[model samples]
Target chain A: MNFNATLIGQMIAFVVFVWFCMKYVWPPMMKALDERKKTIADGLAAAERGQREHELAEERARESLVEAKQQAQEIISRAEKRAAEIVEEAKADARTEGERMIAAARNELDQELNRVKEELRGQVVSIAVAGAEKVLEREVNEQTHNELLTKLAAQI
Target chain B: MASDTLTSGEYIKHHLTNLTFGQHPDGSWGFAHTGEEAAQMGFWAIHVDSMFWSVLLGFILFYIFRKAAKNAHAGVPGGLQNFCEWIVDFINDTVRGSFSGRNPLIAPLAFTIFGWIFLMNFMDLIAVDLLPWLAQLFGQHVLGVDPHHVYFKVVPTTDPNITFGLALGVFILMLYYSIKMKGVGGFFGELAFQPFPKWMFPINLILEGVALIAKPVSLALRLFGNMYAGETIFILIALMYSAGIVMAGFGGLLQLGWAIFHILIITLQAFIFMTLTVVYLDMAHQEHH
Candidate 1:
């Protein structure tokens, strides 16, 4: 083939094709690819961030669970200590009441004994007066008799 | 020269020649009288068939790719969009691998060159007689012209003119980029210097100039040689049918074998052309230090 006007025509066609491709073909495709890459990167980053946040929330929940468990334990221990103190106070009150009642009963018994003894002494003095009267067979002075009886009672 | 009177040599020569339009030896403007006449007509003639087929294939490439580009989206791609994107990606990868320069034109240029030349060379796979036979029929019935004079060569890349034309454009771009990247003085300095001392400047100029010129020459010749040889083989296969039934059977087998192997040649030639172009441009863009 001769080197002729076909050379010029082919060159023109090449130039046109290259121009069209550069202007219309390459940029949009490259831009679309870049945008897709960016989108994928951003999506991965967001996923990672969400995972991190989920982990933090789980950690917080675990910490609160531990804190609640400690608080419940403290409450139970405090309640047990208060119950022991109340039982000790009730025991002390029962012992004091029993002692007081015993003392009162003892005092009542002593008073009763003293009364019996006094009554017995009074009856004995009366019997003695009666026997002396029968033997003497005469009336005696009342004031002198009373003084002797009281003195006898004191000796008894 | 009638079809029945033509010998095997004449038939093959006729099939190989382009439909040239230029100044006749009698100082007239018309179709060349013969293949020899066309060859002797020199630089002023145009190979009409090469130009027509080349431009037609180029338009086809542009229309399809442009449509794909127009409908392109960032979402899932359909068949046409997928094909277009595949081609773009292939060319982009080639350019990215070979070309280190920052110019945006290299990828598209490589794409255009590869696609256009591939389409042109693909015409070789068609039966050698098919288009010319069709043109003969059209010329005889529709145009009221002699059918025997209707010449058409389908494979444009088989023509050296078209291949050289493409290489010439790349060469010009190479020069432009070299000058732009290296400045005027540095461009000449590279051409005349290096791989040699400054004391041997004239020798360096000769050596580098020959090397520089050889780039485009080799690029053009490599493509043209492969395609032209392939086309000639197909023509020779077509020529075999006239010998005898046994010869025709052998030709058929040979045709199938060659066609299968030529497929690789066609694709490889296109790939080589594109790669060398990118490499040359890359060299031009390099700082000559």
Candidate 2:
């Protein structure tokens, strides 16, 4: 409505406020905003790094699991091969023992056969001598024929 | 209302009057009781109400920002600090956009202007008679003065002087920068030899000089015109309250409607003032014609 000293007062007030705001208000606030942005960026970066490490850890665990399975399979295959070898060795040893027992039994049988034959021959010679004695009706030549009879038995 | 004893003209005049305090032709200095008395007090008379509200608002502006500055950190902002930062951020963006110069002063100046002017204009939305009525009551009861003699205009932007004060401050800064960035001769040359040849300096000077002066005048008058017109409409609407019960209801609705509309005007005017100030300062800093 009117012009007065209020304009000067308003301008002075303006100067004072602008000075105060410039000195005390603007800088710290902008600094805070910038710092907050940096903090957020740093936080995001850290989160990304953590996630990458987690992925790497997962991969290592998977690799170790694969290695353990391969070792288990190898150990099982070795055990199976050794068991088969043991079974084969047992079969060969049994076959060899059986053959040796059979050979020994055959040798004993032959020896027994020879002895029996000799005995049979001796019995036959004795029987023939008895017949001759019966026919001759005398015991005079018994001691003298003994050597012959023995020789006959040996030849038989 | 006690104002009912007054005619509509007198009532409107009463609402329009400022609480001017100055000397009379009788060589006595005191508060002016009427518009004529205020005018007769000449240029020496001060609008005490405008001074009070403007100073108080400025104080409030400083207090809030100072508090925000005190506790500022890169943490979650509390309510008051958040509000302060919201305003600061707005001013910063405006300065960044319009003011290419890297001056620390522009943002702060823009902030002060926006906040102070917005707060002052916001007073216009309060019922036009509320503070003046309060002033009247205090004058009558406590100070033993006539209630009719106590005038209070709450909205500081409505006053041409306050607007001019703000505009003039910006203008001075414009001149200061204009001279500082471009030397005194360059500043004068800008006014004397632009959009025309060097030989046509007089016509260019006149054209450029008017354009230069018009910046502050238009800035001040533009704000003053909008706010003053809005304030007048409010005063006129207020008069409708005394006519009858129906008129009072109608006036309330109109007041509410205008106030809703005024929210736009107040904000837009503040924004425009700030943007223009930034643009003008940018112009001052530029080396181009």
Candidate 3:
């Protein structure tokens, strides 16, 4: 091809385009790309930190749940022990009261039996005195015989 | 295009020429009517089509980039932002890999070179005759200009001037960095005296001088040659359409295959140019050079 003024024109155009690109187009695009890279890196780092925190929170929750269950079991076992102790104490008190009531009933029955005996002796003495009176109407004084019969009843 | 009265040779020639506008032989300033007329205008003539297409493509590049830049954010990127960021990252990584110094301009320069050149070269994949044919039609109907005189080359990189223009800009930057980093004396010394004794300074001068100049020369030529050859092949393939229906279908298949292959070539050339620019600038920045 024949060389001409077009060479100079193309050169000028080349310079202008390169200058324009450097001044306007190149920097902004490069800045955007670099900024996006940094942003992505920061986002990824934040995501990693969040994951770590989530894992730690889960671990703490698990530990808290285990501890709470252990505490509930301990409280339930303590309550059961206390209930058993109360039941044993009540059984012991009921047994002692029942034995004391039986002893009082037996004493009352003995006192009743002694009283009946005394009455029977008195009746028997009266009958014997009557028979003696019939038999010994002619012998012995009446008042002295009655006094002896009373002393015999007291001895019975 | 095959239905035209032009022979295949003229068609190929038609595809290669640029729409030149300059002072004619009669001292009249206007568009060139032929390739010989364009040459007659000499170095003063401007290739209007290459300049027009490149500048338009550059503006388009700016529009998309500016839009993406405006909407770019630190959050998840939208589709356009994603695309823009992908290119930015690639250029950044490339500059980082090749450029050792911390010049803020290097990445953007590399980016511009890659993007601009890629867009320019991408013009090659468009049907070789499509835009030129449309341009010819416009010239004929609207401007009342002759269709034969409406020479337009769409792909700018195919022109040595355009590639050299880009290379010259990078070359200037390299020189600036060289002098800035190593001082003028050290830079000259690196060129005039190296890999030999003080007695061999003359030989060293020639050797080092050639090596130094070859950087930009090779850079410019490599891209120009590749693109020019590719365009020529495309034009040659297009000529097959004039032979017959069978030839036209074969030409279509060939054009498709070549275009698919050119996708790699275009991207590779752009990549190579960008990498070399960074490397050359890095060489400039090196104090031990």
Judging by DockQ against the true structure, name the best candidate: 3
Residue A58 displacement in candidate 2 (angstroms): 4.7
Clashes of each: 0, 0, 0
| Winner of 1 and 3 under DockQ | 3
Which pairs of residues collide in candidate 1?
none
Model 2, span A1-156: residue lDDT tens: 667777887888778888887888778878876777788899999999999999999999999999999999999999999999998999888898888888888888888898898779878787768877888886637579988888877887
**Could you give candidate 3's per-residue lDDT for residues B110-146 as a string of tens digits?**
9999999999999999999899999999999999998
Q: Write one digit per residue (lDDT tens) for candidate 1, span A22-127.
A: 9987787776656666888898999999999999999999999999999999998998998898888888888888888988888888888878778877877776
- Regions of model 3 farther than 4 Å from truth: A93-156
> What RMSD does model 2 have?
4.6
Tens-place lDDT digits, model 3, residues A48-150: 9999999999999999999999999999999999999999989898898888898888888898988888788978877677777789775446576667877
lDDT of 2: 0.88
Q: State residue B203's C-alpha deviation in candidate 1, in Å.
A: 1.1
Question: What's the best-to-worst order under lDDT?
Answer: 3, 2, 1
Reference-based lDDT, residue A55, model 1? 100
Cα lDDT computed for each candidate against the true fold:
0.87, 0.88, 0.92
Q: What's the TM-score, to 2 decimals, of chain B in model 2? A: 0.98
Supply the TM-score for candidate 2: 0.84
Q: After superposition, how far is residue B185 of candidate 1 from its true place, in Å?
A: 1.4
